[model samples]
Target: MPARSSSRLSPANSRIESMTVAACGGLATPAIETAIRIRLPASSASNTRFIKRSFEAVEPPLTLDEPGRMLMGMIVRPLRVYVSPVFRRIGLMLLAAVVTLASPALPAGGQDAPATPEVAVTDRVAPVWDGTYRRIRVPILMYHYVSPLPENADEYRRELTISPDTFRAHLEYLFFEGFTPISLYDLDEALLTGRELPAKPVVLTFDDGYIDHYTHVFPLLKQYGFTGTFFIITGRVDARDPNYVSWEQVGEMAAAGMDMEPHTKNHVSLQGRDYDFLVYEMLGSIESIKAHTGRQPHLFSYPVGQYDADTLAVARTLPIWRAVTTANGRYHTTDNRLEMPRVRITGGMSAPALASVLRGD
Candidate 1:
């Protein structure tokens, strides 16, 4: 294509530009014109004097094939009009007009794409920094397979596979020590809304929807009256994978107060993938989980605890309120929701060792 003449009004940052949208849905030319017409101060003198030069230059009839065709040049090139001050805020207005004009004329979806509503520019929402609240010490304990590894399993399997007895010990120690196990959803709600958390709030998360979660993890959670978070590869559930949880078991666990979350449709690192694949992995998984469980999960666990900026952006674009990665630490309100960290529990870590990690030592 002709290098897609591109621009955008960073209404949030006070910048603007426009372009010929690629094939599909986008901000159409008329919509851009309308946004500019509405935002410009509606004085006739201002429109006649300042806004005319920029708008006349970009009003579509002579879309030059050359990319980056400067607006000043476009006006002067054909009509040979001397560019003069069009308004008091000519500089910012011109930049905005240019960016909006250069922005792809449709949403990437197609002409059928819904036009984005034009709203007054506003300041961006400042991030919730770590010091925004008294930071809570909530350790998100991450686990995978709870079954004992087969004899002579490799180191990766060995580290990921903690025995059922060890799992029980970890829960038992937590139960005795007055650690209240909360679901990821509960922690997320408290962290985001400043709600009260349990006295010793900690999260127990299982990845890959392994059957051990139903067999080994769920019963322990019920025994201790603890709520846990389970991240399932939606595609793997009820697939007769032999080691994964069935939809019926997953529903049962959710009924028992476990936070059921998407681990993506298939278990894979969702880094460096295209937008479609990201949509498939992120939105598709959410839909699949909702179809099975009837409730939409608010949290997602990055498959294998892996993600990138693109993946995080996609997670936020959807209904998922937050996401988790493999980085280990106690979560604070200021933590990045999508790239939030977790403390991994592996084979051979006794109850005392886990307590040390949880105590923020």
Candidate 2:
């Protein structure tokens, strides 16, 4: 077989040839002539000038006896004369054909077609509760404050509150959209068995044991039939500060199915603390939760999600099954439960944006 010519063909030219061939009933010669005439530049500067003039002249057409061949010859003669041999040998006719056929398929504005919608295709394909290896994991998200005020606000005056309307919209979206709020126990079981979570399984979590968690957020969660995890600062439980939730409020939330996990005795960063100090902070809070509510928490959320290898080591030594971290990224089964990642919800998170995050977008 003869080696194919290595001339590059433009999409535009290929389309033109296709259209010409279709119009001329699959005959190659006339299509080739039409392609060459359309693609090749006019011969000489004078010929170029004349061709431009001819188009502008707008004269009546002359009838020719040998219309087909004569018209083809007239159209292609200047192209053969003008185009350089290098371009001709490279099959400019092929290039022209591609262009013509492709032009009409393009939008009138010469833009590409709108992009196709993407379907989320995953390798894992099993029901979340099936206890199979192919199941996907659901992430439990946590939030502390959703204040519109800047972080630089005076520590005393800053509010840890999101507006009622925004909170309501968030709750409404979760309910209407069928997001099943699960417990930490459910999450652990899924991880252990490789079970898929519900299609829209998301756990809502709040930290700091804020009074607002009871007064403002709790009613909303209750109204929406959703459950959340609340990690309290053990030392601040009944402090005089109006911000901290009282023991009574914490008890109510726990009774209502919210997990009141430990966030350390003091809200101190435990990363660089000594072993003794770390143990006290970790164990003291766990004991406090048991003493106050009669429920020992197995989960511990790091204060500010700030912990080092030493802190992590201490966490592992303790009876805690999971230690939530401030790291960003969607969770997977292979992720370390002790250093489990949680998406931080804030005032800036819109419904669509939150949906995207929940969907692991």
Candidate 3:
């Protein structure tokens, strides 16, 4: 019944009141909203009896808790004989902000447990970056096929392909050894913005858009709660080749949070290509994957691990962030980001052997 306090509120609460007034189409001035808020004690127990009688002709649109309803009751009862319409509108807006920004309520029986706020994945990995470029040693395992070698397969294919059982063994080894799978984006973020990566970060990349990647690799990665980056050859997928993954399968993988990137349009080497040829191969595949998956591919796997100075120059001109190569080594730095190296996983390599390789033994 007394006048609201003339004291100033905290800067945050003042901003909230100002914004709420603006959002309500200026129907209620900041002073009015502030007045009602300053008067309502969160623990006030003037029941909903006053509100029901005051607005019997029209219902309040909000679904308020017991405390909020009580606070409304106290404010509404005083203004019912005066400007009922104006008070009703202003009361609703101020009450919503008060309840939201106020501290959590105690549970029944007055338990002391406060509701925990949900945290985002980015918040966990985001770092207070200092703007210093740094590098780290993280083995980026690369695979072509997770299937058995085809009959009479060439020596080149043998080096590129690893059997399904061997692939599963590699994942099991990594899991047991506490190797956390990360995307190239993760690596790039850490390099540029000082973002924190997992304790044991490792990158798993499957190149060339192979069909086995979707069939064998996808399910196994999901089974282990791991994610891999797949470098797609857009031309092969567009042609619907049985040996390559389809756009539908690519969509499904992208939706599942797998990193889908570009290899090239026709899987050609960019080492000696001209500017037009380079753009068509690199940017073309990038655009294709973006169209199919609704995510622009920032990471690129140079076709056949081939590139030259021209290639790097052109790649820099595009939106591509990091370009991986078949060269051996895991140490990644901002200086050589465009030519990040990978650890090749070949056939006939056991899980322990892969372990030894990753361990740098």
Q: Using lDDT as the measure, which candidate wins?
A: 3
**Clash pairs detected, candidate 3:** none
- Which of candidates 2 and 3 reaches a greater lDDT? 3
Candidate 1 vs. true structure, TM-score? 0.63
What's the lDDT for residue 292 in model 2? Answer: 49
lDDT of 3 by residue, 126-229 (tens): 32335576878889988888898899999988878888888888899999989999988888888877778999899999999899999999999999999999
Best by TM-score: 3
Task: Report the error of model 2 at residue 93, Å.
Answer: 88
**Error of model 1, residue 54, in angstroms:** 47
RMSD values, in order shown: 15.3, 30.2, 21.2
lDDT of 1 by residue, 209-248 (tens): 8888898889987887888888887666523466788767
Q: CA lDDT, every prediction?
A: 0.59, 0.57, 0.66
Model 3 is weakest, by summed lDDT over 10 consecutive residues, at 51-60
| Local error of candidate 1 at residue 172 (angstroms) | 0.9
